[model samples]
Target: MRPKEIQEKLNIDGDRIKLFKREGIFTPENPPSGNRSTNYTDADCEHLRLLVVLTKSGLTCSDIRKLQEGECTLEEAIKIRKNNIDAEIKRKQNALILLSELLADKVEFETFETDHYWNVIAAREAEGEEFINTEDMYGYRAVSLIRSIKCPYCGEEHEVDLEDYMYDESSYEKENGMGPDVVYSFNSEDGYECHECGRIIQIEGWIREYPEGAYDSEDINVVEGEKD
Candidate 1:
């Protein structure tokens, strides 16, 4: 194939082909005629393809020359590239784990301790790493979690109101001369039927909500919502 044909077939630009030629990395096998340009053979095209792969894998011109001269094998170069790619994958996984902890309220963003490596893993300089902050990460996760709760019965991941369905409610009241005081209690043993699937979900013990200043150790302990 001619240079233009090789460029079209291989999807390589003329500048790259020129650079490869100048570096003696992938030369055309055909000798020049009276007025014809140099031509590349099938074998030359195959080597050019390998050169492209090596260059994209961060190998330099000299490295390709070494490989062409039989100084190093393809498997060795691939092993080195594989190791680098594997390390990059591990770094990304660590960042995701850290983000998950913050989202699950396991770590308070403000008090979360991290080293420089963590920051590097979490954000890249090209993505505006300096402006990244985790202060409100927990709050954002809380809201998103509340919205994404899955219905046990139907396995439908959606938001549903349990106010009307919640049962096994009890209230303790004290009527004094001044006024009245009450402590309300709710247990998850009273299951709710899924509106989507019509299956009853026994939540066991999940706190819905509580009135401010109305909770004590007895009330919380009874429902297993708190431990002392």
Candidate 2:
């Protein structure tokens, strides 16, 4: 193949081929003759195809040279690429976790109308890390947690009415003419059959949502969503 033919067939630019030649990364099988420019063989074209793959998969031209010269094996380069991708995923996940916490903080400190509530996750961030700890994350948001329990089997979900479940402890104490501080603790040992999958879903734990301070016990403890 001629230079133009290689460009047309491989979709590689002519200047790129020339650059590869100058860098000694690739060269024409046939050197220039009296009147001819450059020529490529079938074998040369196959090598160029491999170069295309190497360049596209996050490998720089310098990296390719190192690869060709046996400075690093292809498998080693791929491992490096995989590590970079994993790091990027961690960074993005950390950012998401931080953002969710910040939004929830705003909700906690500021006053909101009865109908002005927004959504927020109930998950906590990792220790000394900015990312949310995905292992302890729950399926439902904090607001929804007051009434909803998710199934572990088929991802079916059930929710009760807040009017049927929740009551302000401080207000209840005041109605009974007793002086008491506020507390927002919810606990239940429940096992309900899911209508969708006909499987028993067990949720036996407690979660408190008091913005004042820390709790002596865990905030949320999910025993197991699906029961046998």
Candidate 3:
């Protein structure tokens, strides 16, 4: 596993070997001469080959050094890289969904609006802020009002489609008509109705929201011939 032996095994030029060592990708204690050189094992040669491929694929020498030193497991590093890829995929999916809904005339505006309203409400609550006015329940913000609805009979939850339920008649009036003034209304005398299950029970709040993002790109197996 002298330099000459490595060069012969890899079918690479001496200059390439020199370059690899200069890049700190591969190193030998002593340079090979006509009759004197240190030996290298087959495992060392394989490791060097893998390093070359990794470096060519955009990994830096420092990254390789970290791997060599056991600072991070290769599995963990791969997982981190995959997680980032997954986040990007989710972002792209959301953007596509928004764009498609915008372009379609028969899109489910109600569902999207309701989900957005609840998200905002949840965000506010997470920040330790009140979404509703405790004194006058009716004097709350649209977001607050949307969050306060529960079926008196079925106990089914309902959310207001705030975006679709806008007061801007000038814009939407020409399209799919207008929404009700009160985003949510319940009849306590009669139990609320579940939209899905159709059960007659006491409603708590709106449960309809947007679907979670699709699978993470990292988790998705790459198919052969696919160029992603």
Candidate 4:
């Protein structure tokens, strides 16, 4: 294809392509030539497509060309670009919501406390049409997690948002060592102290995931020594 056609595919102009060529984003052999009929091959076009996405998502052409020599795969680059896009979109959405609050003469703009708040906000926005309507938003969410649970030791029900606890636990895991977790289930170590009995209640068998922080709980039990 011609340079104009390739530029149309890449959403870039001739000068930008020239810059890329200068920076070695385009190889010497497979250059996006100006007047050549069969200049860019299928493989070249595909690579240019990937490079366009990478550059749009804030990667330098040099960085992308370096990635080609390393263990980084094309799929990983695409995924990274998608994640960067999502993060930027979410950041803008939060800004819009905050701007709405300012328009309503709200007393204070809430400082960003945790990413958990954003996750919950996403959940709330997805769950509630009411807030969206009130805020006149494309979206916004809030879930009342005033949840209660029965104590395994005391057989008494008490207010305890297990979901909130698990959120913190998962966040800790993410910070510590866990990598790119799509879904994480609770284990025996994930537990909480009972409000009534002061005994630990260990929750097991649950898939905890984001956007919709719903838990599929299997069982609630006391610790080994505590129960015995």
Per-candidate Cα RMSD to the true structure, in Å, reads 28.4, 28.0, 30.2, 23.0
Candidate 3: what lDDT?
0.46
Off by over 4 Å in 2: 84-228
Model 2: lDDT to the true structure: 0.55
- lDDT by candidate, in order shown: 0.52, 0.55, 0.46, 0.53
Query: Could you tell me the TM-score of candidate 4?
Result: 0.32
Question: How does each model score on TM-score?
Answer: 0.34, 0.37, 0.28, 0.32
| Higher-scoring candidate on lDDT, 2 or 3 | 2
lDDT of 2 by residue, 1-228 (tens): 887898899998865665465456886678544224468899989988888787777665676788889999988888887786676578568667656766866755456432432222223232443343443253212222335656677776666222122223231234453333234443333434566776654444433433322222324443444435
Off by over 4 Å in 4: 5-11, 28-50, 53-63, 106-228
Where model 1 places Cα greater than 4 Å from the true spot, the runs are 30-37, 53-62, 89-228
Model 2 quality (TM-score)? 0.37
Clashing pairs in 1: none
**Cα deviation of 19, candidate 4, in Å:** 4.3
lDDT of each residue in 1-228, candidate 1, tens digit only: 786898898898866766676467866678333224458899988988988888888776777787889988978766776775666565566567657766776666677657744665546645733322333132111111012345654566544222222344443444443222322233334334445765544433233222322233322211211224
Better of 2 and 3 by TM-score: 2
* Candidate of highest TM-score: 2
TM-score, cand. 3 vs. native: 0.28
Candidate 3 residue spans exceeding 4 A from truth:
29-39, 76-228
lDDT per residue (tens digit) for residues 133-172 in model 3: 3222232222222233344444445552222122221111
Q: After superposition, how far is residue 217 of candidate 2 from its true place, in Å?
A: 74
